[model samples]
Target chain A: MKQSGTIVEKQYFTYGAAPDRLQLESGAVLGPVTIAYETFGTLNRDRDNVILIAHAFSGDSHVAGHYPTDREGDKPGWWDFMVGPGKGIDTDKYFVICPNILGSCMGSTGPKSINPETQKPYGLDFPMMTIGDMVTTQKALLDHLGISELRAVVGGSVGGMQVLEWCVRFPEMIRSAVPIATTMRHSALAIAFNEIARQSIMADPKWNNGDYYGGDFPRMGLAVARMVGHVTYLSDEAMRRKFGRRLQDKEAFSFGFFDGDFQVESYLRYQGSKFVDRFDANSLLYITKAADYFDVVDRVTASGPLKGGDLQKVKYLVISYSSDWLYPTYQAKELVQALKRTGQDVSFCEIEADCGHDAFLIPDERLTTLVKGFIDGVG
Target chain B: MKQSGTIVEKQYFTYGAAPDRLQLESGAVLGPVTIAYETFGTLNRDRDNVILIAHAFSGDSHVAGHYPTDREGDKPGWWDFMVGPGKGIDTDKYFVICPNILGSCMGSTGPKSINPETQKPYGLDFPMMTIGDMVTTQKALLDHLGISELRAVVGGSVGGMQVLEWCVRFPEMIRSAVPIATTMRHSALAIAFNEIARQSIMADPKWNNGDYYGGDFPRMGLAVARMVGHVTYLSDEAMRRKFGRRLQDKEAFSFGFFDGDFQVESYLRYQGSKFVDRFDANSLLYITKAADYFDVVDRVTASGPLKGGDLQKVKYLVISYSSDWLYPTYQAKELVQALKRTGQDVSFCEIEADCGHDAFLIPDERLTTLVKGFIDGVG
Candidate 1:
């Protein structure tokens, strides 16, 4: 099958029986978990060219290419800029697999998914998930795809956390790993932002304790949360260049009530309002919690790095942006240091960019070149 | 009267009524404005020993001493650390006057204050206020007190903005000016955070377009806003030191729904929940908007610096905390540069503190010394 241009459809892979349900990090189990995914490029006969792609907190299975033209807006995939036939991931040379994680709202078994026991939407009934559980669900999907070994796993931000988890969990199963603009564990500052975002959502009475499905969603709170998130994702320099002290419409200060005096305020309001239409508030709460719980130190200390094997088998490429304060260069350095201690083959680079944590999602020639070079080296 | 130790009573100064209403920067007028204030130390016969103390966004007129014990939870002044009899502002040597700004909710003419015409709270009906308007009203209070000139004006953060306004609007009347941890204008980053806070409050249906008084207030939204504000007030290092990966009420991650796993989350929630009790949401909206409109550049360029006189008579001591990214040291430096350009007598200091933008509010020996020395030199 030719895999290029756009993903025309979403695919699902389901597994795990009642007795052999997927065990979560919290000692809970989820049965018959369904994984929503999309793929690009042809799987080689050897099946060794399968590259698993994990997504960030708000991202879904649509990693690249335009959705079907029949869909309104016909928007391209979230990572459409990077994953294509001749792009950084090089779909022509490698089969790229992007899966919606366990607790995401997009076409995956999440809080919105129907519970087998109740035959109704899980809502808040969905068991709490962790980064480890998300990785395990993806691994199950890969197993069902008849792919025993993988070419690589790549992701940024929360996705990057999954990349790290993959390398440590199944050392020999992967050929390479690329985790960009992510931390092994969230800093208190990062967690604080996440907490505020969660509070914004929960504070909205419309949320109704996350059971507002088929009713009024917590759009207001979700928008505010997204607005806060957008601010963190862009650097101060970028915001200054983009919005500065420029006022919206009016040349002078309104000195009016709750008006958008600065262009940045108007921009944020727009961002927040627009975000609510495409995202789920409860999913945001769960995914951010999972990211917050991601701690490589804890994982390593509990089960030791790579168990009884050398980490040399897994090639690692760690990239961070200069202006990504959310997961700053220091965080990437910390992750690289951990890998180095395990005698892993690791290459790290801090890209010079002022786009902050969201730089990985934007198109940059330097990032493209680095990714291309790193992936080629893995071959 | 011994104006020392605990404050036994609150004083009120009423001015600008009916036809002689206080004209705002927006050309709106407010009448019969009452300024609630507190005074410390004795005013000498010369009356030239009066030092005006401006408060920050959420601060009140109570700059020092505890409230009367008759009231429950009679709290000490917000700036009790820096403005005691023997402290930084030195009540022993100079009489200190602190007035709740016109647009503040704490015993002042604000959104919560009754609209004399409507016989109900002004709510959103209150005219939009600026930092300049706040200073203008405070000047009215000073005029009512028979004070012709001020020995100095001291403030930090939004309070600092008021101090800057005092120096610019009444240059000859101020002997010295001390503006700490403040910016001449709000940066896009700063404005973005404030906008998020405002949006969080407005999102609540209970806000009722800022007319929620005599009903359930938008406590939830206001609390979330406070959480966002609290995050910006502390530095990453301070947060790390205070709540580094420490879970709340558990040894490890609960992976439960909305449990506030991290200690920082718990702290923020507590901060948010407690803030709503003492603060009015509408007041927060107005005060923050006022801070956003505080552009010293606009003042300078519009009327030209120092107008018809020299600025050499007004000594300036501008201070910034090392970790105050909300209104970073660079912003303070910018304010100093503006003063220097006009041949003004200016002193600037960046106090080495890890407490972030709130360093000025917290007790620090270095800050106290700098403040005391600056005030002493004013004489």
Candidate 2:
């Protein structure tokens, strides 16, 4: 995994006997696909000191310290603080592993991955994937890494969905589980936000039915989609406090309407433009659909409504932020309450924060202390 | 002077001693402006029964009832309830005159109107206008209509700003005044919304620096701008109630992001698309800027704040909607409280409604009843 100058390690593995076709919950079958992954910390002999972090949409396995060759501008990793030495999770003490989920553009088998039989990128013809399929793929990756158990499984938002998946799919595998700012079932409002973002991407004429690999990308629609998503990520109060009605340059109003007068407008435009530079539009659609399909309790209690679920083997830790409307604290409370009714060890905390849905990404001393204390208590 | 189809008798007049040169508050002048108006009912012998209804940003003299040549889809006017036969300010009694405000495309001499000197659209060369200049133009129109005294000057939002202006600039002319759901000064958030909308319009490449006339109009930018404004016109709860997570055509998710999935996205896109067909981009820019500059109290209110003097001669009524964030109820309360402080007869009511800023347009019996009772009580 070590290299000079922006090292992006790409490794591959074949999981299970390649079936003629593996059917997903959505009834789409994918066959004989290779999965890509990149490893970080070394696994201990006991394999019990492992932390499994799941990637959200548009994220990859780069969850901590930069590759030796990474350039200055490229972000080292999404969760640099928690995984670093002496930080929240502490890389020195615990082995950390993050897998780029299935149906993602980041070092994983996705729509862009070549179909072995056709030897071409599986564009729209790529099999549709459910959140369960994504979790199954992660399970395969963990098996390949020779890790049968984990100290903890931790994630936020869509990442939180994966953490829940790990618990239900293999309850004994996880000693502790932390699902932050996530929902048991996607709300109508949440679905609407995702649907709008998806439509914005799809409406772009440049999309060319998801096969525009060599041509100009659907930048405008993708930018609009990102703009919509970014709005949900930050609170209105946060935006007002940060930018307000401050102007870009001018004082008096320009009679002609051809300039940015307010700082908020400029900030949104900047956010949109920069997002299209790094993210793939198709990947956004696929990942959002995966998130939209996530609902773990329905499977666990299909016959009858579950007052609680079996969490005796798993010490559950749920966290939420006050201002996060995207996945509010109430959703986190539901999970904790469900586990409580099941007579399981569960701790839920709602943190006061102004960052909205993205609060989980920001370093809060209180949040870090809670996470560290909860994980240590589990041991 | 009433016809079956005609709402009111159309009237026009020329004033401002330097009739060829219209002087502005900023000491600027444009030549030979025309004002179009319509008067309902009849003026009293004392010329004191006249009530002036100030128009909003894009509104015209056609504030109530059917226009002489109004087509099927076109509304009678924005506020038909508050001014009609047996209505709020009953046309059978009190004389109500609503004039097309200056700097508007509708009948008023604006950027779209031909410049007498150049025989071309004023466009970008038109001098910037303030709220004061608009009130001044209205005064001249009132004088020509042979009304020395106004029983009341009533308005909401930008119209409310004009009502305040009339009270300040010509206190002797108004007997009673109503300024509803408006503020004497714009908040930073209000300014941010307007500025972002302007930026959305200018961002479109086809704007051609506001000279796209007789060519492909800047429809994309204009549509985007309208979409932004439409969002402000609606409360979050209203949007959620109307469009929520309802899917457009499909039941299951379309993994590809090309088509509209959610009803809200489709609704917003439809609203945006239809807006461009009816509205002129340049007019939108001008009108929004006018609204942004409409502060009754000057920005730097150091010692004595700007106030409408001698409200003893005027009775004031203010109305606001519960969910109207664009022009909140607090603003109407402020206007009413200010008038009361000056020992004026004032009444204020906040309507309970979910539609937000555009609630005034909806057919609400309470609004009609309250307005009618108030007008009759004043009479």
Measured by DockQ, the strongest candidate is: 1
Each model's DockQ? 0.81, 0.26
Task: Show model 1 residue runs off by greater than 4 Å.
Answer: A1-4, A70-73, A300-306, A309-312, B1-8, B70-75, B301-306, B309-312
Separately for all candidates shown, the number of backbone clashes (residues 3 or more apart, or on different chains) is 0, 4
Kindly list the per-residue Cα lDDT of model 2 for residues B200-222, writing each as its tens digit.
55645566667676778777666
Choose the strongest candidate by lDDT. Answer: 1
Q: Candidate 1 on B1-379: residue-level lDDT in tens? A: 2334557357898888888998888898898899999999889899999999998899988888876553545557888888877888888888899998878888888999899999999999999989989998888888888998899899989999999899878877889989999999999999999999999999999999999899999999999999999989998888989999898989877777567889999999999999999999999999989888778876643323447553345788999999998999988888888777777788999999888999888888888898899889876
The candidate scoring highest on TM-score is 1
Q: lDDT tens digits, residues A1-379, model 2?
A: 3423224355676654356556677777787656666655567788888888887777778877666666666666777766667778877678777788787877677877777767887767777787788788778777878889988999988888988888777777879899988877676557656765665566555766777776788787677767667767876556658765566777855544546555665676788789888777877888887787677765433311232343345788899999887787877887777666556678888999887888888878988898888877777
Instruction: Report the C-alpha lDDT of model 1 over A1-379, residue by residue, as the tens digit.
Output: 2334665468998887698888888888888888899999999999988888889999999998865543545667888778888888899898999999988888888887788998877777888889989989888888888888877889999999999899778867988899999999999999999999998999998888888888889999999999999988998888888889999999898777567878999899899889898888989988988888888875533333436553346788999999998998998998888777767778999999877899999889898899888887886
- Structural similarity to truth (TM-score) of each candidate: 0.96, 0.80
TM-score of 2: 0.80
Report the poorest 10 consecutive residues by lDDT, candidate 1 chain A: A302-311
